[model samples]
Target: MTKIVPKILEDPFGNLTIENVLEDIVLGSSPYQVTNPHPYKPISMPRGCGFHGNQTKILIMMYSGPGNINQRRHVRQTWRELKDPNVRLVFLLGLLEDAQYVLEDESDQYGDIVQEDFCESHGNKSTKMVMGYNWAVTHCPAADVILILDETLHVVSDIVFEYIRDLVTESPTRLFRNDIRPDQHTGNSYVNLISFDVAKQFHILFPYIKPKDENLNDYVRTVANILSIKHIYDPYLDHENPASFFAFTGQNVSKHLLTYPLNINFRRLVGRKVLYNEDIPHQPINENLPPNIHRPTRCKLLRKGAVQDQFLVVVWSDAFDSEQRSTIREAWGYPNITVKIVFVVGFLDNHQNKIDAESTTYGDILQVSAKTNKFHDTLKTVATFTWIAQNCENTKFVLFLDGNINVNTSMTMTLMKELVKSNDRKVFLGQVNNELEPDRNAKSLTYVSENDYPFDRVPPRMLGLNYILSFDLIKTFDISFPFVKYCSAVDIYIGIVASKLMLTLRNDERFDRTSHSSFLRGIP
Candidate 1:
């Protein structure tokens, strides 16, 4: 190896940075981690995103600061987009007591924090690879891939998940940002998904070269070259698209990308459609109305004098369950002057004539598609939301319930109106479930494979099939379905989408998930 003298790297955050650990620097020598001891170092690490000793397919270590509590919270919320059990997420943090004095509580609650005493700075950023290497070796040795993600990342798009899964088979040297050019394989602190083998090699080279934050990617390239890892540039993933690359809010942008600033807000879109501005009027399901509507387009408000206070109840039901519909109408869905209840069902195959007759009789039925496949209820859910987005404008709230859920319609509607009035913003109601492990039983109908939905636990969501949502969120769900992975479990799928948008999930004492009838008779 070529020999050279060590240069003094400056940090914007502090003077010391990681300088204390480099007193005995091995300049231009054999690559190894610089672990010289320093004062005030308190490290708290975890053993990968492992469960019962399962080998991890991807190990994600995000670089965060002790002060970046909001960033951490939001990033963690976005992390649920990676819905695979084999994929593990860890927050790599440095010491800073002011913004975060109590990481123990946070770490214990989530069990995904890896803390070290060094203060986070640009100069010290090179140490991230070193720390990640050490942690993976000690805690997640079997992990096949390691992605050094930046804290700025806001949304992990479907392309990202799809690209990472391809990595398991491809095993490329690096997966850099889509914006990266052939001349520049290196990107500034933008997320780079690297093979574990490449990470292990880079960890050793990191301390020896000790490049600055901007030059770090070049060294990463060097390590890939040394390992002979295949390098390929992907064009599908990007920085501007909220469906893929998104950064945190505020003016912080990359000079290259507006000085590394990120944009997190998703454009208002619904599934397989985005023409909400078109004011096409939709007539009621009368005798002249068509029998089936296959993903209809832009529509006016369901009610003529529609205001923000009006709410709609969408019931998911089987196409043939006319009896079930009658029962619901008799029990809780009685014709009311205020609340409008609509039934979203699959197409009636041979019984099309039967549905036509039923449709003419009751103008509340909405056929989304041909018979929805088993475990693909999320499809119908998105369809329902899309119809609402196109049809229900200026609506205040929506009560999404399964046909089987026995809810007191009057009480639920009154409660939802009051809740929306009190909050005065987009909100999610019903049983709020934050962390739930996916079912691993292969034989079970709701079985979740590691590759299918990679998250260790489902993201924060309104649990029971029955719940209430702001109409805006209903539209968001419609637009967001295509961006996320296909989930067979409807509630879990909805929760995953909610997490991506970081919706305000609220639990009501009355919205009990355990029993058949929720909200008035139970829990409260």
Candidate 2:
């Protein structure tokens, strides 16, 4: 953590002293900002061995929070490419309260943690990234290229300066970047790379833009446009999409390689090829993945907003259903400024390019790497909630919907706020199908034999096409996914799981099964 000292700081964290900032004159700086008014003096910075070196290096700068020590440790341990002197990695961090004690130990052990003085927040990402560039220019001037990475990424490449230099040399002279962001976040900060000269020019020449949803990436975009910094988009060389990703891993794993979690695909692309099939061509599905203490999370959705209170919405989608999703965006009044919509879909082999492109453009789709099928939809839905329960426990409510279901989110929002106010738990709000019978026909996918569920009727539950589950029930519901067998119908299977968990199914008349839009259950 940086020393606590008085300085002209924009974020209101606490009294802190950053690095020796020379001036505070630049304001209303970059093109991203309509009017930048923050001062230019750092209050505090991580005290340690600076980004010092004279040799050429590919500096991979990771945006990290103070409490993300485990993530940093993972980066330190798994990134085997750092063996080369031409490659360096550092975690750019911001300050936190009780988290600083553990961070101090981490900083002491590893000289790579660069903690800036500003308070860590989702809103201050632009300032954080600026801090990274500032450190790169002022301290690590020897970096040949800077890879803007995230703390949660598992990098799979042996990126050397020689390979990067070759990439830079072969590209058009105007191109100064190698953006690998599959999801165009802040324009794609997770897996983006900029040349040393561009980083320096941006640091020295550009003005600091005010913080916004599209902060650092917008700033970089502004700089790129101003400098005519065009990057050659090569799938294998510069940025490989899902095809190369599947090629590299092939059938060696089954944990599901999501375009979201594995955002930075800086893998070793030695003998990569475009994969056409969903599964491996000749290889068998590898089932020997190490057992997990908890259920493995497959959802790669980053719903970054006021998720501290509740999960606003999660839409069930198909990988190839971009057109439907696009319509949903407009129909549901998407690009929701408060809480972004998340599209949940299983992977598709041929449609991956489209999915990736759509993801890059909207950055709203959450790809759960599970295969798609009638029997597997339950798994997909459950896995997404499981992932959410583990990663986002603070979430109060979750609205799960089919892609075609156009919801009146404002109405739902009002109902959800009431639910939150009442602190309702074990809530399953939908058109409960209480007397469903399993398909006794042997030929049907959902055919259930007498021994499977000797019961006369299916348990009470809502149809899978749409439903609303409170946050309290998600973890319990997720527990049934691994053990409960997949049913012929997804909703019925969920009902069975609910019955097993003894969760009361609540029927809301608003959930009209006959209508395409069911969430608006009670309205005339």
**Judged by TM-score, which candidate is best?**
1
Error at 75, model 2, angstroms: 63
- Tell me the lDDT of model 1 at 215: 66
Backbone clash numbers for all candidates listed: 25, 14
Task: Give the Cα error of residue 339 in candidate 1, in Å.
Answer: 1.8
Question: Superposing every Cα of model 2 onto the true structure, what RMSD results?
Answer: 20.6
User: How do the residues 43-128 of candidate 2 rate in per-residue lDDT, one tens digit apiece?
Assistant: 33444223345454677787887887776776788664356556677887777877878887777787777765677887776767
Report every candidate's CA lDDT: 0.59, 0.56
Off by over 4 Å in 2: 1-309, 372-374, 441-455, 513-524
TM-score of each: 0.45, 0.39
lDDT of 1 by residue, 253-300 (tens): 332111111222233223224354532123222122123463333233
